[model samples]
Target: MAHDHAHNAPPSETAMRVKALETLLTEKGLLDPAAIDALVETYETKIGPRNGAKVVARAWTDPDYKARLLEDGSAAIAELGFSGVQGEDMIVVENTDEVHNMVVCTLCSCYPWPTLGLPPIWFKSAPYRARSVIDPRGVLAEFGVELSDDVEIRVWDSNAELRYLVLPQRPAGTDELSEDELAALVTRDSMIGTALAEAPAG
Candidate 1:
């Protein structure tokens, strides 16, 4: 958290190219800024991490649902109405006291677009793809997650056929929280296994 990887970094080539294309399209009157903003808003709120957060929250609050989710991820997730394209073959991995789960796509950035909208730039980078498996703890440290040596870290490799979603451990003192309240603590990075769910406010 303290180290903001993208804070001072220059825009990636893909990002720059997208920006240039957007500019050109706007100049040619083919792209409306307002419509672009609206589309981005829909993805960010309606179709992105919010859907994954809701799934996590439901599992936290319902043991039966959690069991079904772990047993058949695709079916369980589809029950929540989040199944499409890249997300058709989902495998939900849960994090417990003894184990932690992280996901990476070594070959390419094959991600669950239905639930997570789009993969982060870091997830698609060559360094992350290669290093996450070789040095998972080190990669996690860079993300500000320091786990005890006793805890086992499992890195799930996603591909074109199967995508993974990390079910982060529920925070303490959240037994009284409602499903929506719990969902609020489930950040995108948490579901991606780069960060933990935020602890509830005092």
Candidate 2:
């Protein structure tokens, strides 16, 4: 009975790399190299972005739900049954006709991981983290989301335990759609106030 080796390469690379590192650790007589590898794998692969999408989508479809979410985000999200680990005390900021909001973890990368998943490559960079608060309008403009000066901008600074998500304005032409269909209009960044969901075409 021949075993399937082709199905083994990508995962094998990590095992191979770990073994190489483990050999060095063993030579120095370290006890837990394998444990370290396990931790890395558990966090990197098992945890991701789907949770963030769920919350965003839910907010898009339910106005009453959205009101609850904005009033007490952590509790409202917990009501959806998606809270813990990377997301606990979550705050939702609503973007509206009068004001536009955006979130930034200026001190460090504090995010609602249980909701949004891993941060995008650009977000983890220094330039974006720095410029988002100091020049939010400029940062948004780069992403093609322009705003009028009268639309007051409020930037939330995320910290270690608290997380923020944006409640994007519902897309136009979606009033006639079903709840599930409207949910599809929400995007992670849009919910976080960086962008607006694209309107459904007529």
Candidate 3:
């Protein structure tokens, strides 16, 4: 709660502990907050879900690319020159009318960073990791996705070696849109199976 936050209250015990640790690390020249900020900014703005969006849009416009992505996600993603430590190996799953796919890292916050940038806070939270596997439809419902009971849900757990990406179904009425236009319709939540891509207004 705002009233209980460290910003509003006296320095919280947890905050004091973290500040003390930061001071110690800074004295030892072991931590640089500016460097951390720069790295985080790189992921949050310059390199983000837009990279994955481009991949999804290309797949939607080109059948061959879609096949390649589904067949070999790592290779197909590397085709776009977006390869890194957390994304050396990736498994792409498709979402259809009858089946939905989701990804989670039960042990830790392993994620496809090259495509997704940084995992959102919720993705790394215990509640999400646990509830996603046990009550996937219920989790999706919390994200405003109410799937039909007839649709089956599949969950994939990602680790350091192989991460998972969900290829959300391309919305209808997008036949006239250009590849870039389609990319604009793809969002971070859609790639994570929490939501669907936006449909063309026309």
Best by TM-score: 3
Candidate 1 has its poorest 10 consecutive residues by lDDT at 1-10
Stretches of candidate 2 exceeding 4 Å from the true structure: 1-50
Cα lDDT tens digits, model 2, 115-168, are 776677677779889999899999999988999998999988786677888877
Candidate with best lDDT: 1
Candidate 2 residue pairs in backbone clash = 48-117, 49-117, 51-115, 52-115, 52-116, 166-191, 166-192
| lDDT score for candidate 3 against the true structure | 0.89
TM-score of each: 0.79, 0.76, 0.83
Q: Give the candidates in order of TM-score, highest first.
A: 3, 1, 2
Per-candidate clashes come to 0, 7, 0
Model 3 scores a TM of: 0.83
Candidate 1 deviant stretches above 4 angstroms? 1-45
Q: What lDDT does candidate 3 reach at residue 23?
A: 84
lDDT of each: 0.92, 0.77, 0.89
**Candidate 3 lDDT, 1-202, residue by residue in tens:** 8766866777879999988998899889999978878987877787779999999999999999999999999999999987786888888999999999888888898888999888899999999998988899989999998989999999887755888889999999888899999999999989988888988775
- Against the true structure, candidate 1 has what lDDT? 0.92
